[model samples]
Target: MADTPQNQAALALQMYLDTSASPLGSALQRAPMMNIGIDEGELATLPLVSEALTGSQRLRATHAQDLALTVDVEPDPARHALVWQMQMAQTGEQPGPRVHNFRPLHIALDGSLAPDLVIHTWRGGAQQSFFPPDAITPERHVLYPRTTAFYQDGTFTIGTHGGRSSDQYMPYMLITTADDSGGLWVALGWSGNWQARFVKPRGTSDLHLTIQIEPCDLRLPSGTTLQGPAMALGLYEGDAAVGYNALRSWLRSHMPALPSSDLSHFNTWTAMDANVDETRLLDAVEQVAGNGLHYFMLDAGWYPSPPNDFYSGVGNWRVDETKFPRGLEVVAERVRQRGMEMGLWFEPERAYHTTELATQHPEWLLRVPGREHALVNFALPDVRAYFRTFIADLVQRLGLRWLKWDFNIDPLPYWQQANDGGLAHLGHINGLWETFDWLRSTFPELTIENCASGGNRLDWALFSRAHVNFANDQYTNPDCIRRILGRMGTFLPTERLNMIYGPFQRREYDDAAWQVLEGSSFGVSEPIDNWTGQFRTSLRHHLALHRATDAYRSGHFYQLTPDTDDLCAWEGWQLHDPETGSGVLALWRSASPEEQVSLHVREIDETRSYRITDLYHQSGSQTVRGQQLIHGLTVGLARDAATLWTYHLVDGEENQ
Candidate 1:
């Protein structure tokens, strides 16, 4: 009813590309124009998951008989959900990964003309199957030009001669089948976080149809989540059941709406510290405006003509009458009269040659055309419409909500002045995704917090709109923030406890309160530039335990094995609440020189009864419980130390 079969694969792709020698619309005129010899520059989109298209012919074996598997399973009564699938044969092709003998397509909810796809059909080395075998008979294993979409209704297209724009690190695709009994053979490979590999059909050649898309925010009728830019399915081969059923119906119709959780505030740049002065920056902005801080940032030599050549700072954004001669509206009106909120720091698409808009226009950046020294190409669309009209005229003349947007270079030799024989990188990564949709539709309330030369484009399409990320240069290097927050919290959420570095350390740093009490206490980097008083009482005791945890900056956990938890580093959080300590137990210090670390604390639920303290060493009450203080806990460290323990359940003994 919702216009089925992707409206007949978008009305059979306007009747098979209307008529351009429809052999898959001449697969872009018998492919090959990715020009191998190389001449012009800038040419992006590259993925077939590497090894140069895994021995070509789309990973060999395209049927002579035998090996046909398709699956589907259903049961989702208004959210009791269950829709599995594995389909791949039936000539809508794409053979590998879809081994025969299927059955699992179960359907219900009445009006059933069938819809339950959860396939997983394997063959040889001990066969397997279970697709459309039950639920009042359903045998759907359909997939062909049957509606293919990477992003629809708005627009999306990718197929640039086998993808892998930068390092082919298992950008996903591993379906195998070879000891032949005939048809079906998909080796084209790559996957990791666990690990996988394939791509071995023979010699390898170009086969890109890659459409690595990601857009699912769906926060309605319950929930769903997926994010941006980690894409790369760019290539088709060995019968891919109509491109994996048109990429699972373009990710079940490109979901959106569900992105909110940053809990901002992570200061820096009140004159990129040359060792803070001006009476230690007016005493660290009156103790970061009485700790209600959201942002007081000013960073990078308060402009006025400093960008000697970052593509030469476009029409220079003012305020450098020689380092703030009472400008930047008097330090943004004394940071809005210290109620807190000022953030600054800009890049306006690089223009440094000691700036003056790069000693005068320099023909608005992005070079390689004639080459007067290159690199500075936001894939040029008039240099991203002159940085979206100079950041919509500097956030409407510096009222500035918040923008620390930094890119720090890396995108070379891409001239693009309406390119042609210029060697395109898919329109320069679609002009870097249209300079991030011109900075979120032109400053959609500025909160762009991103930096490149630090975390190297920290994947998932720049967290779908820079949802506050800096996390690299590891704020003081907490061993690279405990392995990138334990592998990006298995699909981000717990409000992405956004990270940034710097904290009470001096001299290059390694222990700023043991790297901000070991990674992510959301937005806290200390360099109190010289405001001693034990650096304002350790940023007021880490902003009083970051204003009493909002579930350690947005809840969700389970990592009780960091080389066996030292000094209490356990995990737990997923409460709806009704009793028993609602969650949180960071307790810092996993040892460095402070007594060569050794304190393993494992899953402490050991039959309830908890009460730990040390909210920076207690002030009231004999809070001890947890079987009388975790077996008489005697954990302490002082050479650049850090502590945090706030447990409460004063009485507990019920899990019956």
Candidate 2:
């Protein structure tokens, strides 16, 4: 048998020996077992730990320690990309001096590998500059929010942003040749502030790609070891879609399987906001369960009141006795009685000075000395232990099956001042991972949704631990939802996407909205308790579609059309399950007054016939040859309308 790509890329640590490190007084500097290359033609060397500099000024990193690394190569036959990952840590016995930027992995590619290779990189994220709820809804809001911008270039340029808090950075890149034949998809697995720069020098065909953590500011106690984020690079063949599917597969292989049963949820934040109480919540849960929602969440306001907003009472984590005279358990029991699981919303990492945790243990908060709001300090072991116990008790006591965890503040400045500021920052991040490990291990039945003010903390590291993410907080606009759904699945699986549904101006836009929901972890914010007859019927219809097509969420996602800035242009994506020869396509025609366009769907085998059913168009199912479906499908829209088309091979050939 031929040597597989997995075997071809795997190498022993001896191959990555840093012989030159002997001068540094250590030969075991090769502690990190590293590997490189997708094939024999291109190989990667172990990372060279060195001082970081900016404009000739060397970073003031004093505490020097040993670097620990682990590299792995896992190749999937169905995926076009060959996956490679690098994980590193710093082992130290004393406090470090100043904050420093350390590069943990580097890939040096020779020009001879692929002549005229075209390097393509996207900003990965667009900063969320959302409009207030009262603002007039234009035919569209920013289809691509300021926080989620994408860019591509060939030269070495710096595109950096603060992660999670101010900007939602997506550390992803696609590198392919000029012909789009061969390339790699790079995914930065870090959730906190990190940066990536694509450097292509003037003279050589050599490409240098570096992945590094934001800072090394921790003052490590004796014998302490701090680990950094992991990085995955997948090699693929063919076009952008090919690379996208490959990256999806690589992530799927690494992601832990969450609940496979019904996960459709209804959260109250968008609908009720801060005006919520037990009576309202119990009513909402009853209605949500009746309308086919599987999970009911009482978001934000259940805590003690500042009356102004939910932000002030964070960290209190208490159900106001006045609001819920019987306590939160009453609502949880109501939801359970209605046949729905219960979920609670929490901003566990941020707190107001007045809250219990902040007032009782001032030392537990990390913040700029004069800041009013406290950044829940994860650097404290006591704090992490408290959260572990708190969460475990809450879930077990309330019989809660889901938790919506959110982070709404930036703690970079506070972390920079921590015990060993640089290393302190790393410790805070590591603390979150440790907390998650405890939760996952202790409460295997609970599902956690990662929401850093909506999709900011999205990456493989968090995704491997959390079940889903909020794509955006501004869920009212159809255009924005359609655009996000089109691109997000390229980086994350659709099933793991918590697609928020809201009230748009036209009921017609609901189909496009539900298509996005059907393709992911669908959630709605509506007056569920008092739903109308028409609304109840509509909810049931889409809920059924979600159940039937949910399996395809683990399949490959392909962007059939390029994302657009034009108000009238259409954007669409396909989620394909090759094993089943079935898929779902979500196509949207934004206010582009143009009524219709010809869409060419891909991935269907030509010899087969498929039955394409228009779920929203209610146009019914039509059997068409795969050749015709892939060639051209004339789809028309009325103004800002959308369509959800589910297609599967008609004959037994699908399984054959």
lDDT of each model, Cα atoms only? Answer: 0.37, 0.63
lDDT accuracy of residue 433 in candidate 2: 79
True-structure RMSD for candidate 2: 9.3
What's the number of clashes in each of the models? 75, 17
The sequence of per-residue lDDT tens digits that candidate 1 reaches over residues 1-656 is: 12112211111112222222211222222321111110121011111111112211121111232222221222222221122222123243322221211111111111011111111121101001222111111111211112332232212121111122211121222121121111111111111011121111122211222222111111111111111122212122223332332222222222222233334454654223423223444555676677654766665545554243323342365555554455566556666777766676676545554456655666655544553333444544677776677667766766777676655543333423324322233334446655765676656666666554333343334445454545444444453355444333322333433565454446333323433433343565566545456655555566556566545433333332342323333221111112334444443444444443333333344455655555555662244434433343445565445555555564544311
Error of 2 at 652 (Å): 10
Estimated TM-score per prediction? Answer: 0.31, 0.82
How well is each residue in 536-614 modelled by candidate 2, as lDDT tens digits?
7877888887777787777878776666556567767787888998988777776677677777777888798888888
Candidate 2: minimum summed lDDT over ten consecutive residues — where? 134-143
